[model samples]
Every structure is written in structure tokens, then in C-alpha cells.
Target: MAEDPESGGEKTEDASSRKLGKARDEGQVAKSVEIPSVFVLMAGVAAMYAFAFYFYQNLMGVFQFNYNFQGVPDFTRLEAIRLLYVHTEKILMTCLPVFGAVYLTALLANFAQVGFVVSWKALEPKPSRLDPINGFKQKFTSRAVVEFLKTLIKVGVVCLVCYYAIKGELTEISRLYDNSTGAILLFILKVSFWIFIKVCLIMIVLAFLDYAYQKWKFLEDQKMTKKEVKDETKQTEGDPMVKSRIRQLQHEAARKRMMADVPEADVVVTNPTRLAVALKYDREEMDAPRVLAKGAGPIAANIRKIARENDVPLVEDKELARNLYSHVDIGKEVPVEYYQAVAELLAYVYGLKNK
Candidate 1:
């Protein structure tokens, strides 16, 4: 059979092939990293501490050399050494918050996109996972291109903001040369505050952009082809072959039970071509006529053979046989509407037995 290309190149009627293909296509890694708000908060704290250390070292230099030192005491050496504490503290303080925020944001973004599902099924190693071609395809996809562009934009924006901010502060440096201590201290505080604000605004913008990209990537990855949807439905529900087999087994079991009751029949009625109905009647032992054995197709022919072997009468009643086969089952009483027809058939059979 020529395979339908729309059905994913498989000739089989199984819908799952298309579904599995869709799942594979959508499963490509388009993951996004969400930096948590806690990281930004920690970054802000680290920035404040950095500015404080800068102010402290410069103040220390002024105190050490004011009005009495023979030379500008080595402020450079002291500033450099003190910067070790500043850098170290900044890193230590920010590490937990920044990484924690990143982890939290990643979790939330993933949950929002895919729901809160913890399945080890997806983690199971497969032969496809080892394929270099698959890896290369993932690395060079449109999702990867978008991620690269996002990073570039964030870096460019932050650098531009920082450059403009520092450039505007250069003119204030000369005023600090002849100022009262209070004025110089105030100027340093103002410049530090502006820098902090600029960085915070840039960080906020970057975070928003990251979130938007995360949503877009998630939607793109979840889009499904029609064939994929049908295949998944079959896998999750059940295979048609298995269900059909189950029904066949049930029908065979029922047929055996009905045929076993054939020995008790008084007469077998047949449409000859399609139906056979074995009926039993007892005036004193039973209230109504009952079907002992009944069948159609091959089983119908078998019922007539059994009646012949047992010496039970075989009556040809096309209307009664067809009606009984259609409306009743083996071991069930004949319906009220069939009473007149069945009574006449039974009387004729009994009269023949008596003769």
C-alpha cells in the first residue's frame, strides 16, 4: 500500500505514527531560563554594599592625609586591598539570592507552560537522545536563534545605559577637587544612586523580555500536528485490535454455554439458511417455553446437526425462527407476542411424538 505522506509515511492505519512524530518534533529543547526576583533584590543589596565600601576607602584616605601627611599616603594600595572585601562580600551576598531566583523563575515558567507534571518518562534515555544529528538540529533551530538575539539585546541595552550614565557624571568630577568634605561626599552619594537606579531599570527590562520569550518558546514547542493528536489518543486509550479480540472471546464463551444446553431441547426450529432455535417446554415443570440452544451462521447449522443426533424433532418455521433469533437469547422464555405461534409449533411436535 502506498503510504499517505500526511499520515507520516506509514502505510498502517495506526494513527499513533503521526502522533509520535508530532511529539518528537515538539519535544526539541526550546527551554528558557528565568532569573528570579530574589536575584535582582540581592543584586541591589550587593550594589549598595559596593558603593559603601568605595565611600569608606576614599574617606579613610582623606582622614589619613588631611593637613599633616608629607605625601599622599598610598591610597591606591589601600583601595585595591579593600576592594577584595567589597568584591568578596558582594559575591557572597548575591550568590544565594541570584541563583535561587533563577531556579524559582525557571520552575514557575516551566509550570506555567506545561503544567505541574513530574514525570520520569521524559527523562528515560532513548537511542534518539544519542544522535548527533538531533543535537545539531536543536542547536541551530529558530528557538536557539531567538535566545541568542535576546542575550545580545540585553547586553547591548545594559552597556548603552551604563555608558551614558557614567559619561554624564564626568563633568561633576572637577567640582569635587575644591569642595568642602560634605559637598564631595554628597556628590559621590548622588552619582552612586543614579548608577544603581540605571542598573535596576535595565535589569527590570531584561527580566520582562526574558519572561516574554519563555512564553513564546513554550507555545511554539506545544503546537501539535493533527496526526500526532490522533496517535496519542490511541496510545493513551487502547488499541482497537486488543478490544476486538476481547469482544470475540466474550462472544465465544457465551456461544458455548448456549450450545451446552442443547441436550435439553424438545425441538430445533430453523430458517435453514441462517437461524436455529432449540426450544424446550414442560407443562408441569415450567411456566413457559424456553430456548435451550440458539445460533446463526455456522452455529445455526451445528444446532440442527445436534438435534438430529439426539433424535429431537427439527421443525422448519422461518417466521418463528427468525423472530426468536432476533428478539430472544438461549435460556430465555419466548416473548408474549410469539405465544400463539410457538404454542401451535409445540402442539404439532407433541402430536407427532404421541403418534
Candidate 2:
């Protein structure tokens, strides 16, 4: 099919909710991986600081346990293996909480961004992913260029931050040789942890910028053309022509029913050529006269014709017909003001029958 240039070209319209929903279902959400990375890094650094004393105590205890194994100890294979396991357990005890906290932070960050969404569709393999031509286009696209620049900015910022942080700590490094092993270890931890905290804090600003840009871009990508919007609306709500046809059918059925009841009305009032209203009255069955049908133009003409064919009276009092057509409904009593006029008309009709 020949495509309309507008639909195939730039997308200026806002994305429809259906498009957004479909994208979400496909696991195409606007979220930065960097946001979670920053949070996880912060969590790890905070965990390190919180657990520092516990780590120091465990390491000291391990050192003491090794030292207290006085003098004549045999270095058997089983003893070496046992020592390895014990030390490994100690290392895990020192490190596990930080790792766990970082994992939880990553999960929490992801949850805050897109909530709970599991999509195997996103994981499905695509052959186009392996195509070199498509890959080249993807690699050189504007989005890819922005991603590269952002990465470059992050690296440059971190390096500058590291240089300044380390420059002030140069004298501290010189004192490490004279300091106790414990003091040196503590100094190293403090320096690394401080730099880590600074990097995470700085990265947070970049992450926010990236997240906002990604969201804007995602919505822009989802935008549709006028033609596409119309097509989608028709698909969901139904085509206008089909609806109009159904309405025509319904109107025809109603007209037939009204015509069937016209023969039973006591009188049909006409507004000369424009309007007609049929009124039926039965003393035994009703308290007052009720309108059976009313119509304007062609349908009014039909009502008048039906009344003539059935020998039903066609009274054409312009003011009275206009009032009845305008004020009274198809199956209701005339208003109080018109009661005198209607009573006189009915009396005249009865008098004529008596004559």
C-alpha cells in the first residue's frame, strides 16, 4: 500500500494512551539503568560505613585467633583447608550485608521507576539484532550520540573529582608509612568510601537529567499522525458510516411502529405543511388526550397521509397545531392552557357525528 507522507514522516501529535499501554506491555519503558546504579552505589557505601566497626572487630579477632595458636602447630592439608574456610566465612560476614543492601537498592530503584513488570517478549531473540547494517545505523543515531556524550561527561567529571579528592589527601599518604597497620587500613577505607560517596552524589544529577530526557523521547517516539489517530479511533469505536447505517435502520423501525399506531388516534393536528401531531383519547382508558405521534417535514406528511387514509380527522389550526407540536410530546396529555381549545375541538367533532 502507498503510504501517506505525513503518517510516515515526523510525529507531531501527542502519543495516544493505547500506544503507551502497548509499549509498556512490550517492556519499552522510559527508565535509566544509571538511576539504579547510583542508588546501589550509595547503598554499598553507606553499608560499608555502618559495618566498618564490625569489619574491624572480625578482622582483629581472626588475626588474634591465628596468633594465639601458639608455637608448635602442624600445617596439615586439612588444617590449611579448615583455615581457608574459616577465613572465607569471615570475609563473607564482613562483606555480605553491603552486597545485600546494594542488591535491594537496585531492586527498589527499578521498582520506583517502572513498578512490577515481567515481560518475556522483551527477552525474545531478534534476528535483526545481528544485522551489521542496522547495528551501524543504531550506533550512529542521535540517541547513541547523546549516550556517548553522557558517558564521556560522567567519566570526565569523576576523574576531575578524583584528582581534587586525592590532591588534598597526598600528605595523608605520606604519613601512612609511620602509621600503624590498623590506622593505614582505616585511612584507605575512609578515602575510598569518601570518594565513592562523592561520585554517587554527583551521578544523581546526571541520572535525573537522563531519566527526564528518556521519558520525553519515549513519548515522542510513540506519537502518531492524524491519519493514524483517526484509524485507531475508528477501529475501537467503529466506522462512522456503519454507525449511521445502524441509526437509519433503527429510525425506520420506529417510523413503521408510529405509522401502525396513527389509525388508532382520535385526531391528527397539522401545522399546515411543516408539522403533524397525532392524538388519541379514550374516556374509559385515559384521563386526557395523549399524543400518539408527531413529526416534521416528510414524516409529518406521512402522518397526515395516514390519517386521511384511515378517515381520522386532520385539523389544521396553525396556532393550535404549532402549540401542540412544540409543547406536547407524542404520548402525553395537552397542557392546562390548551385544555379549553382541545375540549372545544372534540365537542365540535362529536356534534358533527351526532348530526
- Candidate closest to the true structure, highest lDDT: 2
**Predicted candidate 2 versus true structure: per-residue lDDT over 1-355, tens digit per residue:** 2334967645667888888888889999988978998898899989989989887777777867787766877899999999999999988888898989999999999999999988888999999999999998999987899899999999998898889999999998987899866787788788888899889889999999999998888887777877788888999889999999999999899889888999998788787899988887788988888888889999999999999999888887778888988898767888889888888877766676672
RMSD of 1: 8.2
For each candidate, give its TM-score against the true structure. Answer: 0.53, 0.85
Query: What TM-score should be assigned to candidate 1?
Result: 0.53
lDDT (CA) per prediction: 0.71, 0.86
**Alpha carbon deviation, residue 274, candidate 1 (Å):** 4.0
Q: 47 in model 1: Cα distance from truth in Å?
A: 14
On residues 1-355, what C-alpha lDDT tens digit does candidate 1 reach at each position? 3445765653433334454345445453334453454244445545555556555455555554455569665668788788677666655553544455546655665665445455455777889989999988988877788778877876787688768877888788866788876677767667766766766667666766776776665544444555655666668777778888989999989888877778778889998768999999988977889988888899998888877888889999999999999898767899899999999999999999993
Clashing pairs in 1: 16-231, 19-228, 36-101
